[model samples]
Target: MTHPGKPLIEVVNLEKDYPAGAGVLQALRGVSLSIAEGEFVAIMGASGSGKSTFMNLLGCLDRPTRGSYHLDGQDVSRLSSDQLAALRNREIGFVFQGFNLLPKLSALDNVALPLMYAGTGREARRRQAQAVLERVGLGERSHHTPLQLSGGQQQRVAIARALVTHPRIIFADEPTGNLDSETSRQVMDFFSQLNREEGITLVLVTHEADIAAYARRRIRFQDGRVVEDVAQAEVAA
Candidate 1:
């Protein structure tokens, strides 16, 4: 459940545009939305509909060309690159479609990487990483390298890595895109469990209806703008 009053993410009149050879292409135009703490929100759109661009902005991976973004009440638009990096490290966790794990590193090491970068002590990082891996049901595979793990296990490690930092929000872009149907179901179930049990705000981007259905709220985009925002209760019947 969301907290009484605080919003985890807020966007106001957000816009992003790129200059082409002959003209400018707008990826997002005057989009505004807010996500409260512990909300599981899904963003859905067709190709070139600007969902990816919006996710980039929301994740602090890119800046908006116009307007403002407040993440956990901090004005992200006003932050410098260094400050943005710090904020990202401190507040955001990312799970991508591809399990971008280091081939040479063991699952535990991969999970510990973020905390290590945050200047955490080695022992503490290892302990936290191990706890997260166990939480994600990957404790038995902690020492295995990516190549040695199944796709689902690898993705679990990726999720463990993301959660080890104890982020305020988790941004998952097609997290189940590469998994088999059963694995996808498993992963989605884990996401649901995390949201319900841990109160982590989840933002998922996907093209699949079934995947989007896992989220409590859905937002659809078209021509660089939100065309619909519906609660799952409304969608079910």
Candidate 2:
């Protein structure tokens, strides 16, 4: 969780472009926004609207073509790839639709992999991984592999893996895309609980209105620019 009264994310004059055949393709165009700590924000847009690009920038998976990005009050726009990766490991957690769990590893080991990279001792990492699995309601399934679990259960393991890092913010990109309606709801409920109880900042990317409804704030993008940004109260009205 981040300190109160400070923005966890701040992007100013952000822009991204890719080279096309004898031309340039703009992905993000002068986008600017501030997201406070503990805020749950949903980013919505159609394909090619720059939603993924913006998320990549925010997640430190990719750098902006030109912009200023301050994450957790640190300016990350100028950081090197190694530096950004180190910061990402320390400050951010990511969940994807694919669930990306290692096939051969048991749920427990998969969740502990990040901590292993962080150089935790064998017993300490295992304990932390088990604790996160319990937090995600997968205490009894720690020995199971991804193939042994249901789709929903696999996603829970992925969530447990993300939480094991003790990240300050979580970025979920279409996390429920591969799940059924009921499973999606269950996952969203977990996300809501994490935010409310732990003060974890959450930013979710989705195209479905129902999924976006889980977030307290919604931001829409089109043509690489924000079309609408509104709070749930205003949206409800």
Candidate 3:
């Protein structure tokens, strides 16, 4: 049950620190932002700029050293590890550059993995996974293993896997990093389509300006701080 025109993700004075040698390294310095529902945003920075660390915190893969994070109006920063895991399973989807698929599993099964984790029955999982695969234009490759599919097709399968959960938001980490220019465009186009048609919030982390250009909003990080956050004109999908 999604409510339009609401801030789907909100963070205040967010910070993270990691142990480095005898001291600590600050990865995020009082970062604060909100992502409205259905907005597509890209985070960009150089190496060690803390963009990845910010993404990790936003994705709930890591806990912040300080600050509050609210997802879907719930204070996720206070959730326990098990509760965080459950929340992630139900509310978030992820796409990665590596296409982290099981080598032996068919695309259908890989896409169905999340549903299986949520205790979905075999028949229901199959039905939902197939529907998403078809939506991603991979219906014909449903039975193929990751090793047998092209890089783009495998990424599409990964997209289907992310979509199968009907998540509130999707986080993509360098999702087009390994693809060629044309393939990258295709992937970005598909991401935009999803945001437009399904109203799925998207937060992408990438170092390339070209890749970031696909997003409607861009946030740039430098030295663990967001130095720039701006909205760009929409590009035709």
Strongest candidate by lDDT: 3
Best by TM-score: 3
Query: Which RMSD does model 1 reach against the true structure?
Result: 2.3
Model 1 has a clash total of 0
**Where is model 3 more than 4 Å wrong at Cα?**
1-4
- The per-prediction tally of clashing pairs is 0, 0, 0
lDDT (tens digit, per residue) of candidate 1 on 116-154: 879999999999999999999989889999999999999
Query: Please, what are the lDDT tens digits per residue for candidate 3 over residues 1-237?
Result: 222478989999999999999999999999998999999999999989999999888888889999999998988878898888877778899999898988899999999999988899999999999999999999988999999999999999999999898998999999998899999999999999899898999999999998899888999999999999998867876
Which is superior by TM-score, 2 or 3? 3
TM-score of every prediction relative to native: 0.95, 0.95, 0.96
Q: Give the Å error, residue 50, model 2.
A: 0.5
What's the TM for model 2? 0.95
Worst 10 residues of 2 by lDDT: 228-237
Least lDDT summed over 10 consecutive residues: which range in candidate 3? 1-10
The Cα local distance difference test for each model comes to 0.91, 0.91, 0.91
